[model samples]
Target: MIDATHDTNGTRYKLFSFMTHDVFGHGQYVKHALMENEGSECLTDAVTSFKYVNPTWEKVRVIIVEKGFGDISLL
Candidate 1:
């Protein structure tokens, strides 16, 4: 969720929210139909809550990914 007022500083924040489901598992036993293959499948098969998109505040381009937060560049 992108929010302009979640903090007292009046700064904008973005949260890319998504969900995952694995009926069998993510290993050899997992079925291809049950894995998270596409965005539409997840949004359509979820028990509740459809896809959500938060408003854009400041655009950013992800440069790197790590265990935690990684490098990014403002657009």
Candidate 2:
């Protein structure tokens, strides 16, 4: 989880993770995206949703966010 405070607004990201996408002949590439706000459920609702939606994606370990905005939590 990552949390940061800013003058304008604070942002929070929860359940950060990394995944790999394999291209037939080109080899495998690391793919990941961070979703901020939305609270703890973001993992179950958003992160896990991707896993269910994209069956081809391999499970990657959860990422440790060292820097970000607002208050975030790992699910």
Candidate 3:
């Protein structure tokens, strides 16, 4: 699933909010999919929430791309 909100500047921000629990022996996984507003608070919130779930988990990698014509198409 996805959640979206508009910022003070009326720019639309998208966040991927979903969780999977007990995937592998009580391990919890959170997936933050596509984010529209890069460098915005929304992205920070997404990363924060993911870390909050499992603080010990290390970040494997990260990739940032500029917003474009259609987000859904990227999905």
Q: Which number leads on lDDT? A: 3
TM-score of candidate 1 relative to the true fold: 0.17
How well is each residue in 1-75 modelled by candidate 2, as lDDT tens digits? Answer: 222222433444433444443445342323344555445555445556656766854544443444542234533
RMSD of 2: 7.0
Model 3 agreement with the true structure over 1-75: per-residue lDDT tens digits: 234433634445454554443546462435654566645455566666666776754543333333542243332
Candidate 3: pairs in clash: none
Model 3: lDDT of residue 65: 38
Better of 1 and 3 by lDDT: 3
Q: Whole-model Cα lDDT per candidate?
A: 0.26, 0.43, 0.48
Candidate 2 local lDDT, residue 50: 56
Best by TM-score: 3
Better of 2 and 3 by TM-score: 3
